[model samples]
Target: MADDRRKNRIFRGSLGLLLLSLVLSGGCWDRRELETLAVVTGMGLNYAAQGDGYEVAFQIVRAAQLQSASGGAGGGGELKPVWILRSTGPTVFEAVRNATFQSSRRLFLSHNQVLIISEAVAKGGLLPALEFFVRDHEPRNTQWLLLTPDEPVEILDAAAGLERVSALAIVDLMKQYQLTSKIKPVYLADYIKTRIEKTTANTLPIIRIYETAGKKELLLDGTAILKEDRLVGFLDHKETRGLLWVLGEVRGGVITVDLPGGGKATFEIFDAIPKVKVEFKEGRVQVKIEIKERAGLGAQTTYADLSTPEQFKKLENLQTKAIEDEIRAALAKAKAYKADIFGFGEYLYKHDHRTWQRLQKEWERYFVDAQVEIKIEAMVEELGLVTRPATYRELRK
Candidate 1:
């Protein structure tokens, strides 16, 4: 009887200990509540005029305001779905922490979608301004990075028609790069990786504020070419497309060319592929780039029937010329700026490392003088609804 009672007591004690362990593990002690966090959607960096420091802007989403806006109440009149918090400090990390002083909740950066840097800050060197983001565990490396000539903070405040949060609206705009393939949509990871390369340079899309009908709007314009971490120059939309072709990043876009006689014709690009070859001969480097593109007829202002073999051939030739022109224009602009936005040097470094070492120091000099051969082959596969322009039958003589 005594042995039986001792065994039963031991089993009960073990059961009680197990129950206490389960109770203790029920809740997460380190978990943070959502209400205590001010979720940041975008960030902007600018050179502060007050002192030698950075002025940081945090675009924090207002959940209550966003909910109200989604419900069609317009945030009960005058309330914005996002709050822009500003702070300044000697370093980017300090500036980020300083944002807490203006808000009751802690600023959480895990959901940040965009980082806009002012031209002034970019010209100096972006690595310093971006160091904190890379070192911290919060901000994601995949967020879109933009360079703005206007105040960086202005990009966060720009009015968006569809998206209640301007930061998200900007992200949507960047994603449209696939539709046009003109603006280069560079993420933080891509930008930093290229910037760190020995010869590869960095290029970021430019954002500016446009005032239309007394309301400010965000406009994505041009490309900011960076030599290492400093802003060297910019490439317009056309030149930017040319760079895209060289980089083989062109996905889809429309190319317009002059008709045989008059008017214009637009071709919708379906596929664009570029092949590059680098050759080192007699102490000089030469690059050959060939682009093969397939497009369909999208629109034409001319009544010329492109259904005929001769007319279609002419159309294909015109498209080829136009593609070549775009590539040439980008090359000319890059040479003028002394910027290797094409990464020809990077190619050589990857394939022919020994040769790259000899020219790495003076790569920019050799790049401007490097011989480039461009060849384009464009094919128009599908015509639009009709064999020619929409009004071809009505306007036929």
Candidate 2:
């Protein structure tokens, strides 16, 4: 027993010594000072004009700009919010290392909030360069991912007024869009998972940058369709809502219902809860989607009061039609793209694996011709007891 205890003590002593020696010898082998790095706020990747090459562009914020005293990504005091660094490499990681040639500090990615890629690169295939992203612990999975119609550099360079720098502005812009719009937020982790599942597909938010009067601005183009890992097509604002509806991701979007009179009434959705169901019957798949929502009347064109059940029913029917129309629009787009990004196939896989495997073989062909029926029913419970529908309602010429 004594000898056994002695052996245990020896093992502990040896481990401690080994750890101590290693810790003392390592000496910050990977250490790089903050000043040594450009501190990347965003990154953009494109195809280089060579064989198996890529152009990786970095959006870096001067660390001093991020410090409150130096006017970080939020202030305006003669400090640039972002700077650009570009390099060529065979892969994304190689491009990242090459960016260091122009900077004194190692690139910082922790604050990176948005990643924009060119449409060509995205259509070519994103899964290849994306592998390293997941393996590396530095880049976050929650960061917003956007694809640009133009070269990613141009979009990355667009100056936004909200954030001190363009990179931060894009991030802030995305947050605002999500908060006020019905657009679905696509993240790296979710995107990759959808691509890997085979039963599901993925989408990315698209951004377009334009310049006027020496200042850059951005626009949310909509959603890009992905098949396997390649972008097949894009969805417009209405189509995006359709996609969001299918995925049950609708949060808030203004819905305009053509009223019985001239002009239109705008209803802003406050809450949306959508449910999807998939079932097989008689050798066919049926997908049923249900969306329940509450909305505020943002505008009214005619004299109408919401205090009556008749008005509620009228608005409910109109909303249902409007939502269903959007859903149909989205369905038409997905069918055209022949990709089941809404994961209707995923629902099938969950319910019945045996059929899903068979369906997986010819999923594209089936999706192209498959019948996806969308049913939307919305109810207008209250108008918040409005004294008047709109200023125009009480006005007389």
**Best candidate (score: TM-score):** 1
Highest lDDT: which candidate? 1
lDDT per residue for candidate 2 within 81-173, as digits (tens), equals 578878888888888888778876788777677788888888799877676678787898877888898888887777675556777777777
After superposition, the stretches of candidate 1 with alpha carbons farther than 4 Å from their true spots are 1-30, 74-78, 390-397
Cα TM-score per model: 0.93, 0.87
Clashing pairs in 2: 36-104, 36-105, 37-105, 37-106, 65-72, 73-164
Cα lDDT for residue 62, candidate 2: 65
